[model samples]
Target: MAYQIFFREYFQTPPLTRAYTTACFLTSLAVHLDILSPYRLYFHPTLIMENLQLWRLITPFFYFGDFSLNYLFSMLFTYRCCRMLEEESFRGRPADFLYLIILGCVIALFFAWFLLLPFLGQSLTTMFVYIWARRNPYVQMGFFGLFVFRAPYLPWVMVALSVLFDGDLETELIGILIGHAYFYFEDVFPYVPGGWRLLATPRIFKLLFDGELENSDYHPPAEERPAGFNLGAQEEQANQQQRNEEN
Candidate 1:
C-alpha cells in the first residue's frame, strides 16, 4: 500500500510509467540489437541504432539530452508548453496532454524512421512539427538572452537558426510541433473531450484574463466590467503617463 502510494505520486502518468518506460525499453532493445547486428539477425536500420522505428514511439516524449544543461532546458521548455496547454485547453485533462504529445511523437517518429531516414538521411518531420506548432498565434515562449518573443513564432525562429547554425536540436524542435497540433485539433474538432482541450482553454483564459486585468484601456462593458472605476479613462491615463515617462 505504501509503495503504491509512493509510485502514484512520483511516477504518476504520461511519460512517468507509460512513455518513459517504453522509451527506456526501446533504447535498451536498440543497444542489444546493435550488438547482435554483425550476426545478420536484426534489421539493418535498427542496427544503426539511430532513432529506430520502435524508439520512435517514445523517444520524442523522453529527454533526449543526458547532460545537465540540455536536459534542464528541454525540461523547462517542455514543462512550460505542457503547463500552457493544461491551463488553456478545455478538452484536455492532464493525461490527455501527455497522450497527444506521446501520440504525436510516435506518429512523427514513425514517419521519420520508416519513411524518411531510409531515404532522407534523418527524421526531419519531428523537427518540422515543432516549428509549425510553436508558430501558433496564441503561444509565446518567454524571454531569451536579449530578445523576448511571443510563443507561437518562437519555434520557427529557432528552426531558422538551426538551419543557419546547423545544430542537431531538431528532435526537440519536432516535439514542440507535435505538442501544438495535438492541442489544435483537439480543440477544433474534439472527438475526445477529456484530452488536449483541458490544457488549452483555462490556460489561455488565464493569459487573456491576466492581460485584460493589466490593461486599463480595454474596458469591459458597463454591465460586464469588474467592480472598479471607468476602465477606459484609466487605461488612457496610464498610457499617457507611460509615454510621458518615455520622453
Candidate 2:
C-alpha cells in the first residue's frame, strides 16, 4: 500500500514522459554495465547505410554519453520539462504529445544524418524544453536558484550553459530552431489568414492514445454518501404531505 501510494505520488508521470525517461535510464544502465557500447549507438550515416544498423537513428536519442554530472543534469532537466509539458500543456492529450515528440525526432534525425552529427539526445531534450518554455513564457524560473528569468529565455540560457560546458552549440541550436518552428506553426500560425494546422495528430493516433474523440463530457465520479442519511424517507414524507394538501 505504501509502495502504491509512493508510486502514485512521485512516479506517476504521464505515459510518454515516463517511457522516454525509462528508455534513457535503461540505456545508461546498459552502458554502465558494459552491456552496450556508446559507439554502436551514435548516429553515423556510413555505419547506418553500409551496415544497415537502422537502430542508430533511434538509439542516439537514448544515450547521453558516459555518466557524469553533465549527464545527470541533462537527464533531470529532460524529465522535468517533458513531464511539465505532458501534464500541464498536453493534459489528456497523449496523442498530441506523442506527435510533438515524433516531429522533434524526425527533425533531429535530419540534422544528424545530413550534417554527420553523432548524438542528438541533448538536442531532443532541448527541443522539448524550448517548446514548454515558450508555452509558459511569462512564468518565472531559476537555475539552481542562482539566476531567475522568464520561461522563454530558458532555452537560450541552456545554450549558453552548454557552451560553457564545452558542448556542441550546433545540436542545441538545431533543437531551438525546430522547437520555434513547431511553436510557430502549431500555436501561432493557425490564427493567420489561410493557415491551417500543419501538425495535426491523426485520428487513428488519437484513438489509440486517448481512447475517444471527445473528452469534453468528462465528469468526476461522485463521492459515496455517508451512512444513515435517509434522504429517500424525507422525500417520501414531503410527497405524502403534498398529496394530502391536494386532496
Candidate 3:
C-alpha cells in the first residue's frame, strides 16, 4: 500500500492532491498498525538519547501521538491544507513544492541541533498554511458530528490553546516557526520591494517575516483588490458625494 501510494502514476500530478493522499494513507496505516503510539516517543525521550540518526528527519512526521478525535482532526486538517496549496499553481510547481519540503526539513534540523529543541512534527506547519491562506471566514467544517462556522481567528486560537495546554507538545509549536519561514521565504520574499537581501540571508527568518520590513512592504494595496474598485461600489460612493455637494 505504501509503495502504491508513493509510486503510483495516478498520484503524480497536482501537488496538493499528492500530498493529501500520502498523508491520508500514512494516517490510515498508522491507525491500523497501532504503531502510532510508540512512534511519538521520538520527540521525547528516545530523541534525546545519544547517537541520534538521520532517519529522524521523517520520523516526527509519522507521530500520530494518539488515535483519538483530536489526532483525526489534525489529519483531516492537514489534508485540507494540502488540497488548498495543490490547487494553487505556484505551489504546484515541482521545483517550488520540493523547495518547500526541503525548506521545512532544514528548519527542523536547525532547531534540533543548535537549540536542543524537541522536533515538532508537521501538524503545526499544516495548520499554519491553512490559517495564512484563510482570507474567507465563512467556511465550515463538521466537528464531532456537528457543523460549525469557521472562525477567522481559529489559527491564532489554536496557537494560544497549544501554548496554554500543550506543554508536552514542544515540537508542534517550534515546528510552526519553521513552517512560517518556509512559506515566507518561498512565496512572500520574492514580491517584497527590496528583499534581494533574502537571497543572501535566506535562512534568517526573523528579517523576512517579522516587522522589520513594514516600511518597505510591497504587497498589493487595498484599493487594488477586485472587490475594492468594482464599478458598483465606486459609482455609488461617487453619486452619494455628488448629492451631498449639491445640498
Best by the lDDT measure: 2
lDDT of 3 by residue, 202-230 (tens): 33332443325333322334432222234
Per-model TM-score on C-alpha atoms? 0.43, 0.81, 0.55
lDDT of 2 by residue, 10-118 (tens): 5678778988988998999999999998888989988888999999989989998778877887898799999998987778888888888988999999987778889
lDDT of 1 by residue, 1-247 (tens): 9999967854544333344334433443554556422123222346447644453333333423233443344344444444444444312244434444446655555545654422111122333334334323433345567676655565665556446544445454554555455534543323334533333324343344333323222212443221222446645765788799999
RMSD of each: 12.3, 14.2, 9.8
CA shift at 26, candidate 1, in angstroms? 15
lDDT head-to-head 2 vs 3, winner: 2
Give the best candidate by TM-score.
2
- Rank by TM-score (best first): 2, 3, 1
lDDT of each: 0.42, 0.81, 0.50
- TM-score of the candidate numbered 1? 0.43
Estimate candidate 2's RMSD in Å.
14.2
**Predicted structure 3: clash tally:** 2
